[model samples]
Target: MALITALGPITIDMYLPTFPDIAQDLQVSSHEIELTVSSYLLGLSVAQLFIGPITDRYGRKKPLLFGLGLYLLATISCALAPSFDMLLVSRTLQAFGAAACIVIPRAVIRDHYSTQEAAHALSLLMLIMGLAPVLAPMAGSFLGPIIGWRGLFAVMLVVAVLLIILCIIKLEESLKPENAVKLSAKTISSNYFGLLRHRNFMAFALSGGLGMAGLFSFIASSPTIFITQFGIAPENFGFFFGLNAGGLILGSQISVRMLRKHPSFSVLKIALLLGLGCCAIGLLLTLTGLMNLSLFVICMFFFSACLGVINPNATALALKEQGGRLGVASALMGCMLFLFGTLTSSLVSSWQTGTTLPLFTSLFVCIGISFICGRFVGRA
Candidate 1:
């Protein structure tokens, strides 16, 4: 499950360091290169809507293998992409395939565990997933000079192949025949609408999604802000990036301990509150032109840490009562989550002002809304 979950982050983080090189090689602007991230996220959001009902109707393993196969092909396409447009297309396809890896695992966890247990399980998953953010950029930075961006895609292709083999051999069918939902347009639409109408589910979904918006805003803008504005060397960029990612990992592990004593929603509330504060400080610093590398990085680290708490707990709360509809529920949650990814990434990419203000402003707005939505989860 960890390896499968790692696919999304690895696909994302591993390519970040190569953005400048890719822009140069493909004869595009940096912002144009950033559009690839937005396109990928858009694909991820849309793909889950279709894949969810299929997974619930069929079983986990088959849809997973099919998606992995598609992912393998998409990775190869990405490696061989001849133009920036082609790279965008390939990345969207890659995200389409990776959506299965993300959506199904949550369903599998919900299939076996209660809400609190699922929250605990998700924190463990984040602990594993968090390594990608730490390691992938480091690897990409090291490899970008040696073999270039294409070589990095070749490496992802290899990982995709291995994941395929692992899934075929090790993964079992998580959804039993008895629990399978009937597949149809009507049922799928109805299920999605029902989830849309669900008050508690929407609260947690928006909370988690808005939190992710802040995270993606940071990710989308950080490369340019650090390497271009701050003049950090690409090779050393991973150290600072990894430090923040490590904070996220540490936060997840800490949440596991907290979950042992406190309820998931309570933990989520506190984390959201803290995250909003961090964003407010960051935004204020930016507005006053007092934002330095040290202060900005510190703010991001704490905000990322808060996300580690917010995401899993929000997911647990949202899907706890989903019952046999876990697949679709997970899908909707993922769709909302990555839709926020799409929005923030595109906004940051298009609105680059050669300043950190836009980044921090977006971050502040996202986390502030997330905190508000999170507060209403229990009330709903």
Candidate 2:
């Protein structure tokens, strides 16, 4: 489960360090390379809309295998992409394939655990998933010079193959026969729209989604910001990125410990408020021109830590309210994440003004709205 969950994060982060190289090799601007990221996220969101229902009807193992097969092909396409446009398309398809990796595990978790247990399980998963962010960029940076950006995609191709093999050998269907629902257009529509009206679910989903968007805002902008603004070398960028990711890992472990005593909902509320405080400090530092690399890293570390608390607890609370049809519920939650991720990442890319103000502003607004949304959870 941890390996499957980490697939999406690794795919997203590993290539991040090669943004400049990709842009240069493809004769595109850095902004254009960023579009590939946005495209991948958009594809992730859209694909989950359909994949969720399919998983519910077809069972987890079949759909998961199918998605992994598609992901493997898409990775090869990405490796051989000759133009920026081709890379954009390939990345989108790769996301389509990778969407299963994001959705199925949450559904499986929902199948086995209650709210708190699920959160604890997810926190453990996050400990493993967290390593992707810490390691992927560093690996990318080191390998990029040796093999070029295309070689990085080639590496992803190998990883995808390994994941496919691992799934075939070890992964079992978690979706029970009794829980299976028949698929129909109307059924799919009803399932999805019903979730839309579910206030508690929507609250936690959007709260978690917006928090994820804030995180992606950092991910999308950091390469350009660090390399261009801070004059950090491409090879060295991963160290700083890893440092902030360490904060995220630390926070997840902290939440794991907190869950031993406190309720997930209570932890979520406190974490959201604390995240807002971190955003405020980050914004203050950015606006006052005191946002050097060291201070920026410090502020982001705290904010990332807050996310560690927010994501698992929010996910658990939202999933807890769904009595059945967890696949669709989990899919929608994952969709919300990538949808908001697509929006914030694109906005951060376009809003670049030679300062960190836009990034901080986006982060603050996301966390603030997330807090507002958090208030509505369990109220219904």
Best lDDT among the predictions, by candidate number: 2
lDDT of 1: 0.87
Q: Could you give candidate 2's per-residue lDDT for residues 203-287 as a string of tens digits? A: 9999988998998899878978899999998768777877777877888999999999998989999999999998999899888
Q: When superposed on Cα atoms, how far off is each prediction in RMSD?
A: 2.2, 2.1
**Backbone clashes in model 1, listed as residue pairs:** none
Q: What is the TM-score (0 to 1) of candidate 1?
A: 0.92
Relative to the true structure, how large is the alpha-carbon lDDT of every model? 0.87, 0.87
Best by TM-score: 2
State the lDDT of candidate 1 residue by residue for 1-380, as single tens digits: 87898999889878887888999999999989978877887899999998899999998889988988899899999999999989999999999999999999998888888888888999988888878878887888788899999999899989989988898888889898998999988899999999999888888888988997787888777878899988899767777777777777878998899999998888999998999899889888888888888997899889889888888888898998787788899999999888887788769878978878888888888888888888965542
Tell me which residue pairs clash in candidate 2.
none
Q: After superposition, how far is residue 186 of candidate 1 from its true place, in Å?
A: 0.6
